[model samples]
Target: MWDMNFRRISGLLRRVDRLDHIDRLDAASHSAHEGGEGFSARHHRGVFELLPGTGLTLPRHAGVLRFGMSEREAQWAVATLADVRGTWVCRAGWAFTACYEGLELLAYGDCVDLGVSGFTAVHLHRRGPRLTEPSAVPVVLQDIDLFGYPANEVLAAVEPNLHPTVRLTPPPSPADHLSAVSLSAG
Candidate 1:
């Protein structure tokens, strides 16, 4: 299952890079009016690319599932891609909401393409007039792997709807059986 999912992620990342290239071209040709808001009104859209394993963290057992870019990147993407003058907020699953244009676009994740090395690409965008000083959205990036049965089951009782964090029993091995017999006879 892991292998299959890994492959799928890999393929998706390639497609993302290609699409970003196309988006860059589109931004260059676009001529959109900047809305009179604090947000920058540029014709270019920014593409945030995630490298595989980049979001992984150990103590929490959850990786950096999402990222809210630096102020510079955010402004760049919004101006280039979004036509209206508005502030863009990246919501869950890479979805962005532009307050001015009222536009929502879903950005997909591509960690698998990054492979073990992980991904690194410029989130393309065009410079636009600043509506207000660009500010980054405060995002509570959660670890996707730390949720569900594997993490929760071990911490609590197994329920029909809830998965356990730990495996209920370890698989039997020769050493385990031998120890059991020795203890029983003793």
Candidate 2:
């Protein structure tokens, strides 16, 4: 199951790089104004890009944050981008949420399994879904604007490009809206 999801994510990465692969996304929805608010109006604080192996870049920050970073390093990374809202510790490792206004980042570290005592997962999300409102941060998965485009459009474009390994767990309907995206190594 895990391998399949990973492959699916890999497939998504490939499809996203293809130019204008999803027409609906290119249509009327691309505009922050037409769709609701353009990315410019959302007051985006930074742009984050996908990194190999469940990793992501932090704009204006020195290094990329990927799975296997130490808890301290992860916390420092998030702190540099936004305020650390809260943190939690468990038997396996630790987790925390950082926020830059409405944009939020969640990261988790693992002390066991996968043979690492470091971060294993990272996620980005809006404080809440406002349908037409733009996101505080834009998460670009390949070239697709995970938050800029409508949820339905993103899903539609992604579903078809999926490698047989991954499937949308419940298969989103035309109504689904994208609220969050995650990268994980475990």
Best of the candidates, lDDT: 2
Give me the runs in candidate 1 sitting further than 4 Å from their true place: 1-14, 31-44, 56-186
**Per-model tally of clashing residue pairs:** 18, 3
RMSD of each: 21.4, 10.1
Q: Please report, in order, the local distance difference test score of every candidate based on alpha carbons.
A: 0.25, 0.59
Candidate 2 lDDT score at position 114: 53
Per-residue lDDT of model 1, residues 1-186, tens digit only: 753464366441223333344455455444233332222112122222223323211111112222333334433444444442333223222222232222122222223333211111112111232212111110111211111112122123222422221112211331110000000000
lDDT of 2 by residue, 1-186 (tens): 743464366553323343232333444355744755333222234566655465777755535787788888877877776777656645457888887657677777785755666887677777764745445555666466566555666676766664332222221444444666777664
Model 1: weakest 10-residue lDDT segment is 177-186
